[model samples]
Every structure is written in structure tokens, then in C-alpha cells.
Target: MVMKAPVADARNGSVVDRLVGIDLARGLAVFGMYAAHLGPDPGEGGLVGFLMELTHGRPSALFAVLAGFSILLITGRKAPKSGIAGRQAIARVAIRALVLLALGSILGCLGTQVEVILEYYGICFLLVLPLHRLSAYQLGLIAAATALVLPQVRSSLLSVAPNLLDPVFNLMVNGYYPAVTWVPFLIAGMAIARLNLNTLAAHWRLGLAGVALAVLGHGGSLLALSSRALTETSLWWSDVDGAFEPSKSSFIVKSSWIAAPHSETTLSIVGSTGCAMIILAACMLAVDALPRLRKLVWPIIAVGSMSLTAYVLH
Candidate 1:
């Protein structure tokens, strides 16, 4: 959890010159995906399902927020000079997203495990492109709205206009994001960029807020899940194929244990909680020993750093 200290001189080889915590978090996030899906299917009501519900969906959110943070941190420098960095920033993300889209398609077509997050990340990255111009607060508001509307928007689009919804549309809708869409996460990252969230790592209050937000976001989702009772929802649907549906491949596997209606809310709450905690922990894990752990976690951190690469490669 401890990250290497930041070395301001990018010309010099310094872990801080690169985003260490994000890489570590990314590495952890990918592994979480591997574990949650590649392992045994946790039936909707089983113990493993419960664990998956809590952890599986959370890391990506964290990954995505970091994605935005990275984009801003890397590109924010130009915002002050001539908006030149901002332009380059857009181009960088655009090229990366296109590659991801292509990679996602390849993974979906070729891999036995067709759950391609590369597509979602690619799509989300594109969505964030325009939001780059907005202030952090504006971006955050947009993100919040996107989160609230995404599920409903997706459901309606699928139900009413499946034919109109082409493959790319499907990829964006039921394909990748599902209920807890990554768009908001991307925007949250963008908002951070618009504001200087990285600097806040030094602020105790901000760190506490990150903790509080994590607790509240995760806990509230859990409470809501417990109270809402998915059995009552009109949207409850299951694959019932008794096989891992690659089409339905998401961060979480298609298992009966966590597949029940009740688990949806549970997953969101736990996932969000995990996301919040990971971010907070990443920031403060090892102020002293980060230099050493950084070396240890470097591979994982690289995985985190090249999440797009990994996602596409997968």
C-alpha cells in the first residue's frame, strides 16, 4: 500500500515522477477481476458470491477514478500554458481509446472469456474527452448525473430499442457498464483533474473525506440493497444458461451465488466501499516504506499503469 515518494524531476528516474499508487491500485484491480471471474462461480446465495458481490465491481470504479486523475495530472500542466497540454491530452486519450476498442473487439471475438472491459474503458475515455474542458465541479456534477441516469437510460434503450441499438451501442449499454456505469467514475476522475486532487494527498482533511466518502458510498449502497430487495424490482433477469455467459461477462462472473436479485445492491455497496478504501489506502499506505514496496509492487503497479494495455490484451 505504501507508494514511493514523488520525485518532481521527471527527467530523473523517480517513482513519484510516475503515478505509483495508481499503478499499484491498477495491478490490484486487474487481479481482482481475474480472481472474481476466473475462479469458481459464486452462486447467488453462496459465501463466495457474497465476497464477489462486495469486491468484484468495486475496483474498476477505483481504477476509473484514477484514470481520470492520471489524465488530468499528466495533461493539466498545459492548462496553464496554452491549453496545448489539454489538446495533446485529448489526442492521447483518443488514440488510447481507439486501441482499446479494437482490442476489446478482438478479445470478445477470440477469447473464451469474452468479457472485455477494454471496450468500456475505451468508451468511458471518449466520454470524458469533452468533459475535460469543464471545471472540476462541473465535471463532478455531470458524473453524478450520469451515474443516476446511466442504469435507467440503459434499461430503456435496451428494452425499447434493441434493434436500433447496434453492437457498439450494445457494447456501451448492456455490454460493459451495466448498472454501475463507468462513465461517472471517469467523470469523477476528470473532476479531480479539473481540480488539483493530487495535491490534496498532502491534506489530512481531504484524505479523511476520501475515507468518509468511501464508507458512505459503499455503506449506503449496502443499506439500499438490503432495504430495496431486488425480488421486488421489475428488471430482475437471469441468464439461466448454467454456463458462463461471455456475453454477460462483466467484472463479476455469472454465478448463481451472487446472481440473485438481492445481490445487485449488495455488490454495489460493497464494491463502492472497497473502491473508497483502496483509494484512501493507496494514498497513505507507505509514506515511509513506499520506495521499497514500490519495487515489490512495480509489476503490479505496471499492470495498474498500463490498465488499458492489460484490458486490451485480455
Candidate 2:
């Protein structure tokens, strides 16, 4: 669970000072990413693999959602209060996005597994500008549509030009999440943040609903993939040279929703987003239960605060 930030700081009253919890969440997401990348490969059928699958590839979704949440917290505060302040808020976000994008490019040259997230997140950050203005309902709609459409869209693109489907275009054309599908989730996160969710514990209904949605969403995706036996499609795609089909015994399907060279999949969308909410809610509960851990959360919070920078460095 990300920490609940105070509405404002009592000392200096700066917005940045109020964003400790947000920083913690972002920092932890990077930690998850680093652990997954640095850890030994959990073989396809092993429990380690399952754990890796859950943690290694999915933290980015949390980071992205938090990014959206930040936008709402920072911008919504001033949007209704003063237009000039709102514009400045937007510019702040834009500059951050640009900086991250540039930094991500530099990070990519290091040949690290974490490189793609910086690129993906930098893009998602830019996308938050227009989406920050959307209603919650609209944000939900966008999230749903993108999650459903992106896979199919890439599938279509792969069919049209198989050669172009190479890894060089994975961030845009193929799975885990191309730029098209992921931004909406951030928008949804922004919407969630805009609702003053931290103060709304009185309404357990939203959290309940989120849990239900997550269970159904993730369970349904798993069922769909298991039924299809499209578990590993990389070798098949590579073999055909022009056509792509999945393999029954392949590790790719069970391990990742996106196919390799990039391990992305339709199932990953369900898992990443659903798991994010589940983990967040759980974190919230855990923090409420154990005040002692607040001190422990600092390292993750620091990582979260400087996530983009650390991500670039990683």
C-alpha cells in the first residue's frame, strides 16, 4: 500500500513536502524492478518463476498508476482554484516527463533490463496532461478500452507486417503494454487519486469493488490463456519468419503475457493492473495496522521519490 500523504505540510506547507507516501510508492516500485532484474532467472515451471512473474515485470504498472495519481494530486488542487496555477502544474509535469524520457534514453544504452520502463513511463507521463482533465468515468472508459484494444491492435499490426513486428518496436507495437494501452491505466489512477481516496475509508465499497474487479479481471485472463495453450509463441513466431503462432508447452505464455524478445501478453494486462490495486489496498491496510513499519518504508519511499533518476541510473 502506498503511504497516505498528508493534505499539506505543517512546517513549510510545500506540496513536495506533502508527497512522502507517493515517493515511497514510486521508490518501492523501482526496488521491485531491480530485484526482478538482478535476481537469478526463475525457470519457466518453477515457483521462483511464478514469483518473478508477479514482481519482476509488474511493478511498472504501480509506478505508472502512481504517476497518474501524482498528476491529480498536484494539478487538481490548483485547477479549480486558479487557472494560472493549473497551467504551471501541467508544465511541471511536462518537464518531468521530458527529463525522464531523455534520461531513459541514456539508461537504455547501458543494456540493462530496466531500460524499457523508463522509456515507457516517460511516455506515459507525457500522456497524463490531457487525461488529467478527464472525468473519472471517462478515465475508466479509456482504461478499459486500451487494455482490450492494444493486444488486438498489435495482433493486427503483426499480421499486416510481420517484419516490422520486431523488438525494436516493442514499446509501441507489441505487448506487455505499448504506449497506447498503458496511459489509460495512469489516467484511471489519476481518477482514483482525484477522489480523495485516502479520506474515503468510510466507504469500503470502492475498495471492495476494486478487489472484485481485480479478481475477476486477473482470473479471467489466466483462464483464457490456459484454455488457448498459447503459452509460448516466441519460438513459433521466430521459426515461421513471417507468421506468428503460439506453442502449448512454451514458457512465454505462462510466464509473460507479452511475447519474447519482450515477454508481454494479454494476461499481463490483467495481472499487472489487478495486482497493483490489490497490493495497494493491502499496503494501505498493513500500514494502518503497523505503525512501526513507517520507518522501514523510508528506503522504498526514497526510491519512489527519485524513481525516474534511479531508473535512469539502473
Candidate 3:
């Protein structure tokens, strides 16, 4: 049996009632980003450091994925519009992207240590426009292809176009968060939204799949680390030593493919994407399992509802 919760009508009720869990998740993502930005450096080696390490790339990945979900919601969820309405919706999104890009550029010039993601995010919004019409299955296929193929493509492109100022190179190769590598997360989020998330069975399946993917992705990284060939070819010994050093600039290895937290490698994408799915599934289950806690969770929901504003202020 397909054990399920009541699905919200696509056209009914306030936005909160339809997707409270998503908003809460967004709030959590924002909080995580704050912790990453303002919290003590994880390289200091302590309880706080360990916690920061755990939150590092995972939270940002969740934010990217949630961006995709938000897009679907804004475009009318599973029932996307056509004709005049569709054109108008696209225009609105384009305007939002432009605004975000402007804000990000302004913020970047301030010289804060924080690597502003808004610029990359704005570009992603525009890049994903053509993909908005794809079905969930189609999006999934594209996401998978991106995760598996894009990194290799990036490595090759980097070999040829090493200049960071090149627009294509910047977006795909060496930017803070390359849209090419991150697009999979966005696509996956949209695909997940198309699923029947208002159901125990669906949640269980998604959660389990997430766990499995995390293990697979992380395990692959570990195996790569252990490989004699890889160890000999790269600066693996220094990288391993650097991993343990307690410095603000020390690398936090989250994937076997690359030790850097935001390397945008294939394994990093897979592992981080898995983490995002797990968080999303858990949020959905929590909303169903703990209805009484809604009052307590209201602050998070409120933060999530105004995420764009909150993100800019932070």
C-alpha cells in the first residue's frame, strides 16, 4: 500500500499551508549559511569546529536545491502555465535574477571575506529557465547527466581556458560555485517536487535513496583516496596533512574526488546532493509527524518565507 498524507490542492489555500515544510527547510538553510559565514572557523579543532565542518557544503547545496523548488512553486508547481501567463511568469523570474545579480555584484565589491553566492545564483536562475518546462523524469535524467559528466567537461575546459575572467570559464570552471556543477541540485529539487511528497511511502523512499546515494558517493571518495595511483599522481600526502591542520584556510575534505569543500567535483556534487535530499525528506516527514510543533517552528517558517531578503541582509 502507498501510505500517504493529504495532498494540497495546487490552486487552494495560502502558500504556507501547501508547503510549510519547504519554507522551514529554507529557513534552516539560511541559518546554516549564517553559521558558515559568522560562526567560528571549523579549522580551530573543537566541538564548534566539528559542527561547522558538518554544515559546510551541505547547507549551501540545500539552498541551491531549494531554489529550484521555489521556482516550481512560483511557476504554478506541477501545473505550469502557457501562453500569456507563462511569458509573464518568465519575465518575473528574469527580473528577479537581474535584481539578485545586481545585489550580488554590489555585495562582492564590499570586500567581505564571504564568497557571495548571489551572483552565481542569479545566473543559475536564468540558465534554468529553458528547463522549467521539463517533466520530473526528464529533469532527473538531466540532473544525473550533469553530476556524472559536467566535472570531466570542466576539467577539460579548465585545461584550455585557465583565465578566470572568461565568462564561460568563470561560470563552469573556477567560480565560487559553478552553475554547471550546481545545476544538478536545482534540477533534482524540481524533480523531487514533482513527486508525491505528501505520503509516508514517498518520503521513506526518498530518504532511503538519499542515504544510499550519500554512502555511495562518500565511499567512492574514500576509495579514491586509498588508491595508490591517485595518491602518487596528486598532492595527496600534503592534502591529507592539510586536512588535519587547524587553520582558517585549511581544506575540509567532503568528497574523495577533491578535498576542497567547494571544488564542484562530480563526487562532491553527488555527496552534497544526497545530503540535501535527506534534509528535504526529513523536513517533509517532520511536518507530518509533529503537527503540534508547528507553533514552535513558526519562526523558522517566517525566516524561510523571507529568505531572499534575509539572505541579502546577511
TM-score-wise, the better of 2 and 3 is 3
Model 3, poorest ten-residue lDDT window?
Answer: 232-241
lDDT of 3 by residue, 121-177 (tens): 888888887788888889889988988998777767766765758765685567978
Each candidate structure's TM-score, on Cα atoms with residue i matched to residue i, is 0.71, 0.77, 0.85
lDDT of 1 by residue, 48-113 (tens): 765664445555666666777666665562252136755776787788779877877777788565
For residue 59, give model 2's deviation from the true position in Å.
0.9
Candidate 2: where is the Cα deviation over 4 Å? 1-21, 44-49, 77-82, 165-170, 174-177, 200-207, 226-267
Best model per lDDT? 3
Model 1 segments beyond 4 Å from truth? Answer: 1-16, 44-53, 77-84, 162-165, 178-180, 194-207, 214-218, 221-292, 312-314
- Where model 3 places Cα greater than 4 Å from the true spot, the runs are 1-17, 229-256
What order do candidates take by TM-score, descending? 3, 2, 1
**Which structure is stronger by lDDT: 1 or 2?**
2
Return the lDDT, model 2, position 185: 61
State residue 30's C-alpha deviation in candidate 1, in Å. 1.7
Q: Candidate 3 clashing pairs?
A: 221-256
Estimate candidate 2's alpha-carbon lDDT, on a 0 to 1 scale.
0.60
